[model samples]
Target: MMATVRNPARDAVAFVGVGTTPYLRDAGGKSATALACDAARTAIEDAGVDLADIDGICGSSVPTVSVQAALGLPAVTWWSNSSLPFSLLVIEAMNAVFSGACTTVLVYHSSLRGAGGSKTAAADPFRVHNASDAHGHNAAMTAESPSGTYGYCAWAQRYLDTYGVGRDALGLVAINGRANAARNPHALFREPLSMEQYLGARMIREPLCVLDMDPPVDAGDAFVLTTAERARDLGHRPVLLHAATSGRTDRPFADQLEDYTISGKEIVAWRLWEKSDVALSDVDVFFPYDGFSIMALSWVEAVGYCQPGEAGPFLAKHWSAGENRVLIDGRVPINTHGGSLSEGATQGAGHFREAVTQLRGDAGERQVPGAATALVTPGGFLWNATGFVLRGG
Candidate 1:
């Protein structure tokens, strides 16, 4: 039986402010708590709201209590610790606001991976030494080790094999992201990456090169959400949350995935579209997670932008022709802030920030002209997927 689809609680809540600390390779002794506070304070100020007005807080990776203490908030009536992919935090914040549990809410993400504070183990999943075996490793070891790339590489290979594409198609994704990053001052890698450079990059895993991965960094991103009426009374323009949805596949592990080429985004995208008036064609900006270049392609296909396994040709036709193709003014502007691939990884919050900025017409150099709607997917790894459709109000 098909479930009844209902429109999202449209305009019930909206994002009024977005903020982030300067992404850095190392925060130079700054703790995740401190970074979260910095971003939260900035967001609070950006929204023209006082700290006391923040009745709710939502985050993952960093504790909400620490953030509240660091910012010295009077009290928070609602708080939640959302898990992975970052988009869940946004949805949680919206839920809190709509339930009247809180008038204004803060959602944030902070990571200290690049500061050597939370370093991944050196285990390589592809190679099994006498002392260590990939299949026998515990869940903690698997999640905390750099060896995870092995699974992503496996998916990349299967994608190529299934679609009859080559490594060059993946190169196009990297090239497009780097090109956008070159124009963003806050991006970690701002230099223009040519196809020659992308193809020649060091191989991290077969078919997946160094350029295909997002570098871990120490940074924080935050946003303020409130009722649309309250948002209008605040400083910045409100970016309405038209729809949001999240889901995970029963096959959680990479080896157990039902389809190597598919990420769980298709599930979220289906619900997101069913719950919103907006369609893919109505999106002026698209921000699909690019923790890995292939992940972005997976999302592109999952969201019905193109047929499954055809994202390579679609990108080649639309993203290959320099600035005139997918830039801010192109047919489909994407990842205007360069995404996690180029914009220092903020655990996908950077994508949300850019989406709000573009909708507000404040993305100075990377602004998508007349951008009224945006679709953002913060999912990869064929699990724990979340998506949102936002409209400018």
Candidate 2:
């Protein structure tokens, strides 16, 4: 059954706090819960609010209860205790906020599994087919990749055949991320990436090179959500959560998708537009998921910023170190914090934290000037996606 639970809208829900453990490829000294607590503590302090006010807590589905015990999380008004992706947790956290069950909400994720560990011999059954893959990145599939080990490749190859997308087009994506990551201090890969390096990178899946996948990393991140009115009392700037949207159909995976070119993330844009007054042109920054490069391009198109099949050219023609027309006259930033592909994946919570940073004007060197509006997205598996358009109002 679908988790279509909806919470009634309040006057407004705002993100008053955000925090994270330093982004690291491997945090050997830190346990996932330790990172999670650090992030949660930073958020609580940043908001200048006490934990007593936060009655609701939602978390990414890692294999631990330390987060619950650490924060003394009360019974979650809307808990998703499954291996659902990060985007789902954000959507559910918003639901709890809207339900009037809690004025302040803390959402967190921490994990060591993502820290470059090889899957054990008796790994999760889902990863059996992907064990021999060049890299472990694609050793599992979301609902979108129904072919299991080969589903992401299947979708990418279809995009190439139908759209005539060349291997160079994929290079364009890596280049965009690499350039942005270079400016991101929190990013793991801060070095410059050339087309040669990206193209020559080990092939993970047939069409997806190593550069296209997110490197495994260990870390944690957290966000605090409360009403705009309540947030006003807090010391931090409140980035209004204009809307939170989730979309899916009753299908199993990519095999059942009606259109290979259109995924659930595209549908999230449609829902985002339906709920907010923000226009596509008004978006100051975009934090679309960078778990995979192809998905990032798809989200750019899905969000209506560019037409379908136009992202390859958009990134190739417009992105450069000193020139990026997409954001602020070649200076407007995207994924300024480098995102999952470069910054390291913290079970998707990383994206949400970056969005908060941009909104709070705390994004250090990569900060977008006068960035009052930002869009954050998390997507995976077929038809499973979440969207948030945050504005500093």
lDDT of residue 238 for candidate 2: 84
The TM-score that candidate 2 achieves is: 0.85
**How many clashes (backbone N, Cα, C below 3 Å) per candidate?**
0, 6
Candidate 1 wrong stretches, greater than 4 Å: 114-148, 261-263, 324-329
Residue 80 displacement (Å), model 2: 4.5
The C-alpha lDDT values of all candidates are: 0.79, 0.68
Best by lDDT: 1
**What are the RMSDs of all candidates, in order?**
5.0, 4.9
Candidate 1 positional error at 299, Å? 1.2
Candidate 1 on 106-128: residue-level lDDT in tens? 99988765312233312322111
**Deviation of model 1 at 13, angstroms:** 1.1
* Stretch of 10 with least lDDT, candidate 1: 126-135
